[model samples]
Target: MAQVLEFKLPDLGEGLTEAEIVRWLVEVGDVVAVDQPVVEVETAKAMVDIPCPYAGVVTARFGEEGTELPVGAPLLTVAVGAPAAGGPAAGPREGTAGGAAGSAATSGGTTEGSGNVLVGYGTSEAPSRRRRVRPAAPVRPQAAGPAPATAPTGPDRTGARNGNHEGPVPVISPLVRRLAREHGLDLRELHGSGPDGLILRADVEYALRAASVQERAAKAPAVTPAPAPPAHAKAAPEGIRTPLKGIRGAVADKLSRSRREIPDATCWVDADATELMRARAAMNAAGGPKISLLALLARICTAALARFPELNSMVDMEAREIVQLDHVHLGFAAQTERGLVVPVVRDAHARDAESLTAEFARLTEAARAGTLTPAELTGGTFTLNNYGVFGVDGSTPIINHPEAAMLGVGRIIPKPWVHEGELAVRQVVELSLTFDHRVCDGGTAGGFLRYVADCVEQPAVLLRTL
Candidate 1:
């Protein structure tokens, strides 16, 4: 007699009710080992490749590509147990489940439910069954049995289904559930260290760290887990309460916080950037990546910060101290479909023009692709927002959180300016800098702006600054 096993979609991240199945790595009739990648799913944060947790001959693929399957939905099936007699002896082969690996399956097809199991026998725990796609509408409750399993805490718990209680109410600790949910670790796979096989938070954390190491050693890079949306994230029947759970949501929250917390003062100046334009054109002609006016503006900001260290400080609201940094890490406001992401280029004060150009190029590309790491989004000493690309004149940009100052660059246009004592059409750009008054005085801001203006007027001044 053959034993069958099913693989359901495990929670891939926190409270993720559904996930878009991007691609299937395995097909029907393929013999797979435990922990081998089976499918790739695109969540809000990144594309995650899920690993198979069973070793056997694959029999079916329940969820097709592009389908948004809920957690605990059957993803694939396998038949464990003996092979058909007179055909081939199917016994446990080692190196797969720590149980067996055998020759690939010969015949199979993608199906919705169980089908055509054979006579061979292989052994493992019975596969966890899948829940129905949609739960029946809740009737008026007569009586309650027990509380259901809580959602896991991390990004990996994305595909977790709604409440289902069938097993003996497991004694799940709060932190364990939080760790499992946050990291997307499947609680079912973890053997508990607590009494009565109760999994502890430490056990889950250990498993996560160990598995991450193994994954890295196996050449599969661990993806940055997107933070979970709030628990109260729900859609009302009358109006939608979409969770700000992804990159766009994050950007919105950060911008809102900055605007709320920072006491801002805006200062504006206009500068002739004719030489800066010429330098940019020369760089583009010499096989550079066509670094934008934004890059030039960023370089100037770095120089300005060097002259006035107060602008490079952050208002420490919690400690009521002004935290200052010795180095400049200038963050550029990169606009993406997921709203705006500010990816910082560190040590901008130390890098030359070409290096700054390349770093900004790579960072912005990663931002647009939604592949930027959490580290890339943090640790900026100052920020620069370029509205020039959008043909805007100038507007005060709100400073990013904690950071005391932000510089906004406006569009450069050919305008009449005093050049060699003659009013001639020259490239002119507007600059707006908003600083927290608590950290810097007005004189410092004015001097810094003048320094930046001088650098923009003569781009070669940056060569000496570097």
Candidate 2:
């Protein structure tokens, strides 16, 4: 006798409320062990594998690949109990529900539960047996009900409208409910397009738009004339439409918000990086582990930030104050097939060039593989953008939102410049700093950029801070 249990999508931390199914690891009727990954889902931050807490035969699955499900939505159902003799176990027999429940309670082979606290399951231990209660008999319309001319069919509609719905409202996000309330729309009047009739934000928005159009039509005159297109004009062909979702969508939102909210300023300078290149070569020639050019630049950025702490801070709009951070959690932009992700190297100020190089390499590999966790993708204090790899000479990078500043580095190329008094071919690179104007004025921004340029011109300048 097997007791069926339902497992819902768990919260994958970092304030993520929904995830798109990437792949399914288990199939219906397959036996799964406790803590086994059942499906891989892509959230806004990263791709994650969700584990099943129950060990049993998978009875049913909820969503197909690429289907997006909200947190607390049913992912699958598992039939738990001992396997039947000499064959795959079967579902519980009808009318033996009580007997099977009792048997499962006393069964020695059954697992108590997997003590895992993910999104759906809490920290509490798993219950020994699921409580089964007899459902009330369905209410049938009276034989004389044919006399009524106006009776509603299907699931109760007036429950949500009258605010007396007993069961769950099918809506997942609070933001969706808020949107409906603000527009004076009733959630009950809408049909959800999601799985199991779950209400979504788009559904609410569409209802609001429809309601607005209806209201305008009722108030306006119906006999208005319309204008026609010119005979010389031609209809446009439809283009391929790509959905703005997942990582690309997240990037779009963040960049748009930064442009809308932050008052930013950009300053750039070309520096003779020949000395820095030579110093890096010399260090590699005598070192156990080779130091990377990015690491050296990162070290310089940290030193520059130490001198001008205002750049290493964020503006707290709610607090109406600038929050200056003591420690530097440095973030570097890495481009992958998925998209551009800035992986943060925590406590970067305390790390030496070698350590920073190693950490950068590790994070870059993780980013390319799409295995970087949500924690690795957030909590950045200041960002260092190395656009040099893209073969670009200069760019005014949009500051990563909330972070006060971002340092952009361009490709180092050999250019004719004055060495001492005479002309010489020297390695030169363009450095740009994009800062939040609200945090500091141009003077402070110029000083910070100047220090970085100085370090590039003479690597020894960084030794003073070291």
Candidate 3:
């Protein structure tokens, strides 16, 4: 007898709560194998194919392409084993119990299957479905249930009423907590709209906007606040209004968060790269595998990090401590058609130039194809951004947040430079280092930048550490 089972959209890690249906690989009545990819989804992190855990005939698909679904929403239903005489599960999808999209009427006992879903996510046990509750006015949510849409408004029912409650706030995403902390919003004072009273980014943002509006309203009588310019103040310009979602939205949120939370500063220096370029050429000329210029710069970065360990650390605000990482996982900025992504090269401090070049190549290719996993996309200790490909001379790079520093490399072009007391057309490059002021001061930043410049001016300087 066939036992029907349902597959929910599994959690794609890195704190992603939702994904948009990019493409569907299977249709109803299609036979699929265990661990077969059933759908392609675009999360804020990347585009990935989601494999199903169960091996069965697809009985129904839930959401259509382009539908943005929260994590754990029903994806499809499958009919396992041989069919019953009437074959009740062979028909089109019907609504499931509790208003979930797909039918669960034919669902029986749990069936064991492979749990591989994504790199860091697995889907064996069913996850709870997420629902957005739009209460009349948000009530201080309890961990047990959601507030009704007709929740009471006014100070009497404000979240501050539960401020005295002794329990940890229900927040699963670190990003959401960070966003709230940046704005000085108390999590206990905001009602979460996620499942089981879980706090989400949207909830924090909404609360901040509401607070902003109220602040202006409160000051309206004291002063002529909330400007209403002359009748014709020029309507806001409008063009194509693209919804910020997927990778683009993720980048926007992260960059904004970084600017909000981090006190960062930049220092740049111009260097004679004649010897560095010549060194790379020499290595290639005598080579097993050609080393990339980026790899050489990366080697210099790792060596400098060893000398100035403060630049290889992150500031832990809550713990009031500086975490100096022993190993470097170097991330390089990659621009692809999808968007800009940073793929980290693990144990970068230990690897030689050849290994770094190969890993960078592989990760870059994966990033361009939108196939890089969540683990590959995160856990960067430092970043190396080569903006030279754009033919630019320099830029004050924005430090990638949480990480203490970033090294920016500009065009290594032929310029008239004074070398050994003589002016000549020599290869020159500009290097910029942006560091978090909380982690290190200007002196340390300067020393790190100077070390990198020294390595570029004289390649033998790196050999001392090598």
Candidate 4:
């Protein structure tokens, strides 16, 4: 007998609550191996491939690609255990599952799955079978019996105004419960629009809105409703609307929070980068691992941060303290097809030019390929935004939220400038530093920018601290 075991979407760490399905690797009736990536999902942070822990013939798949599923929602079901004679059991072996149950499926050993899964799958229970996608028109939950509903609490649980009989509430997310509790709305009275009887946040909100409408309607006198707009006005020009979700949504949220919370200030300077460019060209010509210009700039940044440590920190507003970190995890902005992602290099203060170049290359490749992990996307103490690649000269970049400062570098172009007192064409670059005003005043910010400008003009200035 083949026992079908269902797998749910695991809790991807870093407080991520949901994921939008991007692609499915396998189909129903296809055999999959244990730990083999089954689906690619786009969370708010990054793109990740979820691997199933059970090895068997895929019996069923849950959602279509691009469907947004909450954590713990059913992903698929796999048939485990032995088949009678020459069924899916005798097919080509994909790979074995963890232990005994896999042994039975392949070698007629024992039953029961190994339950050994990845790190994020910690105690994630198998979700009940509820596969239908919610249609736009509201549908009431169909149950084996009437799905048991919890009665409303507090003083509002009186007779006709209260919820139904008390029992289990089919809600998975704590956030949904919190929203309902705060509004004093009865979850049992509303029809759920989720899989099975699961009460979602949208359902609660809809119920609240409906109640408000009814309350207002009851107090007002009956009147004729307004007519629809004329045909000419209805046929007005329309525009393409994109849903703000996934990485784009995350960027929108972080940037908005940064604007709301951080009291930021920007300062800029133009530097003759003739020396910095020469230093990089000379380093490559000498033939040791080729160093990137970004690496050299990062080296200068670390050196400048050592002199002015206040810039390499985040302010704790609630604690009323400016928390200065001892180590620097430098984040650099990389624009990709997906969106703009800032990949961080850990312990950047400790890396040399050669090491920094290698790490930057690795991260940039990952960013372009959409394979960067959440860990690589976060934990940046200070950001370095080189907007020069776009062929622009200077921009006052918004601070990457929670981080205190971001340094922007503009395109290095040949321009007429005074070098050693005579007019000449020099490689000039603009450097802009944006800092949280709460962390430091104008003097500290100015000194930091000046030090960076000095380093760009004379590369040897960096060597003193290196």
Rank order (by lDDT, best first)? 4, 2, 3, 1
Best candidate (score: TM-score): 4
lDDT per residue as tens, model 4, 1-466: 5556666675565557789999999999888876678999998888988877677789989999999987656788777657556655422122222221122121111112122211133212111111112222322112113323542332231114224657645553445565788888766665444334345555666677778888998999988989988877756467998888999999999999999999999999999999999989999999989999999999999999999999988988888999999999999999999899999999999999999999999999999998888778989999999999999999999899899999999999999999889999999999999999998899999999999999999989987997
Instruction: Please give, for residues 216-269, the per-residue lDDT of candidate 2 as tens digits.
Output: 999998775877878988877789977777777788899999999999999999
RMSD of each: 16.0, 9.1, 9.9, 9.2
> Which wins on lDDT, candidate 1 or candidate 3?
3
**Model 3 Cα lDDT, one tens digit per residue, 1-466:** 5556666665554567789999999989998875578999988877878766566689899998999987655688776656457863332222222112111212121111111111114222112122222223222212213344543322221344335567656543444566788899888886554443445456677778888888998887665557778997899888989788998888888889889888999999999999888888999999599899999889999999999999889888899999999999999999999889888999999999999999989999988888877667788999999999999999987777889999999998999998779989999999999889998889999999999999999989987898
lDDT digits (tens) for residues 1-466 of candidate 1? 5555655554433233345687899999998765678887754434456666455688889877877675445678766546566764342232222132111111220111111211111111111211112112221111112222442333232223323535522322233465577888667665443322334445666778888877887996667988999999986578666556555555677779988888889999999989989988888899945676666677778777877898999877788899889999889888887677788898988876677888988998887776665446778889888888899899988788878888888989999999999989999999888999999789988888888988989877877767
Give the Cα error of residue 122 in candidate 3, in Å.
4.2
lDDT of 1: 0.65
Superposition TM-score, candidate 4 onto the true structure: 0.75
Give the worst 10-residue stretch by lDDT in candidate 1. Answer: 117-126
Residue 458, candidate 3: C-alpha displacement in angstroms: 0.7
As a whole number from 0 to 100, the lDDT of residue 9 in candidate 1 is 57
RMSD of 2: 9.1
Question: TM per model?
Answer: 0.58, 0.74, 0.71, 0.75
